[model samples]
Target: MNKILLYFLLFVGIQSFSQELNCNLVINAQQTGNENFQVFTTLEKQLTEFVNNTTWTNKVFKPQERINCSMVITITNKSGDLYNGSIQVQSTRPVFGSTYSTPVYNVNDKNFSFRYQEFQNMVFNPNQFQSNLISVIAFHVYMILGVDADTFALKGGEAYFQQARTIVNYSQQEGFSGWKLEDGLQTRFALIETIQSQTYKEYRQVLYDYHREGMDQMYEDVKTAKKNVADAIIELEPMNNRRPNSYLMRTFFDAKADEIEQVFSDGPSVEITKLTSVLNKIAPIHAGKWRSIKF
Candidate 1:
């Protein structure tokens, strides 16, 4: 009996140690002339600490049980931009395992200086500002072409995005100003705006292709899938509002939620199919100003 117990303990220890998340994370970092991507020595250490020490288990991730994350950074000194790179992560559980890998083939160069400056200013204390930026960048990559919500939310959302927002807002008050949103808004604002990928429109076509190729469609029910897509779109609108849009697309919503639900009908794919037909017969006129402010 004692021998059996000892063996069981060994098995558990092996499993725990083997439960590592591994992947390559490449940063498309570059610099101009003499300056280059200089990851603060501390920042590099903190990232290592996060992966090696955190309890990123099944509770933090659903549909999978363990996670392995790895990264490689490429810094170009002449251009001060991220030319290209990639990251890969995997998760495993007792009976299941999954992996996610993304290519940073394109890096939005909207805020090169500000971004690098932020990284330069970072220290080794695990401050909220530094932590959030890391998360924001990771989230951006995931948003651009990420297919796994479960992994993203579990791995980065709470630890980074939610906390990052607080840090960003705090950096703007009576005592702060260096971290400005304007400089990075073009590429970075998507997180704030919550825009869903426009790729969702291809759902039906993807379904047809899967059928043609003899692959299984994850959602067998069309209506249910549509509803889910709609919900996802609605969720994106609040975040999307932080960015500027075309004129016509800008007039409908009084609040972010209203804009998402009413104008877009909580679905990103539902384009305005009958805008001309709906407005053709009526002459546009401004309404009278409210005689009194009435709620």
Candidate 2:
């Protein structure tokens, strides 16, 4: 009877602490020109395991409930154990009562330089900087979590964003490029800092309003949902006026431009005269897409 009770408790605990991310991690070393592909293969396998198997949050996530995301690490150069590359991180969440999934976060990190001996253990130590490889991947994982959470509830992702911030703080001492303010405007340092700043508070609020209040409601009320989504996006104009062509704004549109075009083009027309003007003002890079919005 004691053994049965112990087994029951253990099973419950396992269910309570399931991993949160279902990630499809790809390591593309085609440009490295290393005919010996064993190291790249091994690195891909180990990193996949490291990311998908690690439990990220205290909240329980069942297998199907895990956030759907992908990370592509493109290795551009290799010198001994040092590797130089870029990483593109993208994540999406399912819209309620629909078969569609909406893109939530997407960013390409260009300063992905790291050292890894083949067969090196990929462990994530949040309180300490383990390796540039681990820290970079872990940092983006929390960013994905934070952005996904924010879409569900207003500022719901704060705890996860704070974790990403902690990673930024811990990783700065390593002299890596992306962990510092001087690394350029699009670095991880700028991304997380912009996200948490009250000056850009509308960005996070739009994430919630666009997803939970807008996309999720499309099945029930298409016109109202489109208006909500447009209103949520237009709210960013004030922030753009303050900080033009900001990293967060670019990141938001990078993931959302195509979807936005599609949504506005096909939908029951909400008055978008103001929306088009706002889009051109804030994300002019996507002007071609905005122009293609039919109605």
What lDDT tens digits, residue by residue, belong to model 1 across residues 207-271? 22322211111123333333332343333233334433412122211111221122223222333
The sequence of per-residue lDDT tens digits that candidate 2 reaches over residues 128-225 is: 99999999999999999899888887888899999999999999999778999999999999999999998898999999999878887776777888
Q: What local distance difference test score does each model get? A: 0.30, 0.86
Error of 1 at 211 (Å): 20
Which whole-number lDDT from 0 to 100 does residue 83 have in model 2?
Answer: 92
Ten residues in sequence with the least summed lDDT for candidate 2: 9-18
Q: Which candidate is the best by TM-score?
A: 2
Candidate 1 residues lying further than 4 Å off, grouped into runs, are 1-23, 27-63, 66-74, 78-160, 169-178, 187-190, 193-223, 230-295
Query: Residue 65's C-alpha lDDT in candidate 2?
Result: 79
**C-alpha TM-scores of all predictions:** 0.35, 0.93
